[model samples]
Target chain A: MKILFPIILYLVVSLLLLAPCALCQDEVSGCVNCHSELDDGDIEAPTELFKNDIHNQAALGCVGCHGGDPTSDDEDLAMSEATGFIGVPDPTDIPKICSKCHSDPVFMKSFDPGLAIDQYAKYMTSIHGIRNSAGDTKVAQCASCHRAHDIRKANDPKSSTYAFNLPGTCAACHANNVYMAGYDIATDQHTDYERSVHGIALLEKRDIGAPACNDCHGNHGAVPPEVGSIDKVCGLCHANNMTNFDQSTHNEYFDALEMPACETCHSNHYVDSPSTDILDGETSVCAQCHNSDESPEGLEAADGMRKSIDSLNTSLTVVKEKLDESDRKGLFVTNALFTWQEARQKEFAAKTAVHTFDLGKVTGVTAEGLELASQADVAADDLLAGYVFRRAGLAVSVFFLGLLALLLWLKARQIDARQQSL
Target chain B: MIDRRSFLDWLLGGTVFAGLAAILYPAARYLEPQEIPEAAISSLKVGTIEDFPLDSGTIFKFGRKPGLLIHDADGKFRAFHATCTHLSCVVQYRKDMGAIYCACHNGRFDINGKNISGPPPRPLEEFDVHLKGNEVYVSLRG
Candidate 1:
């Protein structure tokens, strides 16, 4: 009887504590509950699936959008009673749902009035949206990338779209062997990307210039780009290189002879490790297009760039050796070359620069190679000065001390002789 | 007659004065009165708190610097600098993506001013914000 009283008292206190929350519960249901089941075909609905979302936890509820009786417990009445009950929306209807909040200039202006309101229109024009509109249900929808619930900030590491985590998210579909096998799509893109230069740059060196999945693929309306479009996209950042490549003998030859341009030498997609070694200058990319019996122009153009790259590499080697010797001799050296220790740094810049045919930048950077050589020479001069002055000082001091010792011994002998004579 | 001790003192004093003049000449050139005004420390009224929609961001220009005022879905107000940490590019808020994105280098920042992606070296700095009556006051230091 005594224990029963305490249990009843505990229940009463708990209920009293829960009363405010229960009263406020009506303002906390999902927008889907009321708006998702209407007969309106145009209304794209996400359903009450977002009830467990963080938005709901913040007291955002169903009546906030799809007006309904929140207090009603009856399922049939809850479905029938809501004012703006829209039917279950298809993938094509996602844009309408997204645009409801996004398109309202007044609503968005409160947050970012200047925010772009054209995402829905842009998506419609995108390849992914077009394919999805045609009823390719397997295509990624808004919820696929953005997530239906648990939607956090994109900057959140836990968010699906964060750079480091995006590869894994993309792999969700791309790595699915069964899904890929149907379309003959190789599942090795994620693996291959992990090993590519961009992959190594991003994953190992944390270079942001290294392209991620979306760098090549569109963020919202992703699709496979045409082979011809790759250079134009890649050229956005590599302007100098792209310009040189277009003007190079290869591009000229291709334009005149009606052959493929730079991609002929640099294959698309599966780019291999580009080596700048003089002895190993001959590349398979050049050999494929040039060495063939039909086109001698490809062979000649490849040889010219190959020679320039070789000379640059040789100059760098000489500079590096001399710089190392200077460092060993205890001279401090500072320059762009000394700062960029990895050979790949200059090689990447030089190789791309050569393709652009910007002889000025090519010459300027290549001149830095000669300048590094001069820095080595200056370091050597300083070393010689140190050695000469230090040795001369030591020799003079030793000679003077020897002469003084001889003079002192002679005086002592003279004093002894004088004493004997007396 | 002038004593040797007095003559030595005069010599030492002359040397010291010369040394002080030499050092101060270059330092005086380097030192200049600051011309730029310090950022306002007191909170300035932005707008009514009710004007900020839930789970949205509003960009406002305070002085010469651009700032983003974000009202989270929970009705909590936050302010972040619009400048990028990497290259000082202006960042825009993508509400659907829920990130402050820099288009220059694809830099991304969370609503809480954390660097999520791209080449930014540090998180975006946040401005202090408070609500008084119906208006929102943002601190320059914040």
Candidate 2:
């Protein structure tokens, strides 16, 4: 009874677990499943290959496509010689398998169909598809980046080909320098990208738009660009700026000197906020190229502007100290009222120093120094008023105490006089 | 008759007394050690127990601070300040190693808020938690 009972339980569990997939496998059970019995057809395209495919893992079986009595285990009943069981799909019909979901507008809407269109069209043009069309079957397909069963949103950090992870995905193939070297391909793109501004910004700041290797090179049908066409790639966004840069004397000078082009100032990867000081005088980026002695005027202007800024900063420190002192002495109301006035003056002074070369702005700048002095006078007046209020309270309290003491002394004298009279 | 001289003396004495009182009041305030106010505690909600998974550390946001909610394998739930006391970077839960790690300076904290490694001078701040029905509550004071 124990042995029989164990066998009965095992059968019940197995039947329950396998029921769903077993039902699915009855119909459209492909040629590969029955291939051993059949005398017709090549055997190389193994059913084992489809085990890793998305449909198989999802438990959708061969009956979904080939169509027949999936319930019937008998070969003759399941495989009708005429109309029952169909064979494997042709290479041409591979698109139909993909299009089942891809062609459905509603199903593909969540993924943004425009992206799929571009991806599919680009893939067809890619070397993989071209070779596959010519009957070379080992190239990558749609399921490569978007995994078979584990497909997910691009924004998900865990997604295999997410923006942050794309480099690592491409590096799987491209970073193998030796393997790719045979194909005349260099994998140094990853190393160079890591050092570029785009790479640093993407890694450090997590900027999504910062271009990686796939942004510049095609993910599927990538090719190297001509040396003359380098500027065109850069000119996509920096067209007007590059045009002016091309006309500038620096471009030709760099060409002659064998120095770096516009990228020397702007940088190629991970470009940052440009320093305004760079434009103010020849001391910044220009100094990198031109000798400091050659441009005396530019160098002098930069130094003068710096000194003015420093002087204004020093003045601001003095004004802040006095205001703070006033607040500490219970002159809060007065300081609060006009302190911003003095503070604004200091701010304007700083602005003037920063833009000293602009004479028109500096003329209006002296008003801040005068305004600061006037506001300090107002705060001093407010402090004097508070002192008077404090003094008044003290005077009244002291007067009352003194008057009471004098009254007590007089009453004591009266008492002594009365006692003497008695 | 109250003479001008006497009146002036009285006024001067009153001013001195008032000035002294004004100075002393603020001085007393400065001398007193600030007691943590009860009003500050009332506003803090460490979050309910259901919000935290019993087997993992869930991050809870309280005011400007982040708190960690950890559920042990034995089904016990605990919450600690996510801030590293050393430099204030948010500490992360390392599920595999069963420890909390600070990325900025590598400060490490054990499950009980004890500073286990790196330069942290103190343990993480722990809040008292209670479960009522399905909801969990955290208090500012343990």
For candidate 2, report its TM-score: 0.37
**Model 2's DockQ?**
0.02
Question: What overall lDDT goes with each candidate model?
Answer: 0.62, 0.58
lDDT per residue as tens, model 2, A6-106: 99999999999998667655432544466534554344333545555445655566554554555566767675645446555444444445566666778
TM-score of 1: 0.56
Task: Report DockQ per prediction, comma-separated.
Answer: 0.03, 0.02
Q: Model 2: runs farther than 4 Å from truth? A: A1-115, A123-153, A182-186, A195-197, A204-211, A216-422, B1-142
> Lowest-scoring 10 consecutive residues by lDDT in candidate 1 chain B?
B34-43
Cα deviation of B136, candidate 1, in Å: 44
* Candidate with best lDDT: 1
- Per-residue lDDT tens digits for candidate 1, residues B26-113, read 4774597622322432466779987888888887755545678888888888887777786565677878878887655557888888
Interface RMSD, one decimal, each candidate: 15.4, 14.9
User: Can you give the lDDT of residue A321 in candidate 2?
Assistant: 64
Model 1, residue B132: C-alpha shift (Å): 48
Off by over 4 Å in 1: A1-26, A29-92, A252-274, A277-282, A292-297, A321-349, A356-368, A375-422, B1-142
lDDT of residue A338 for candidate 2:
42
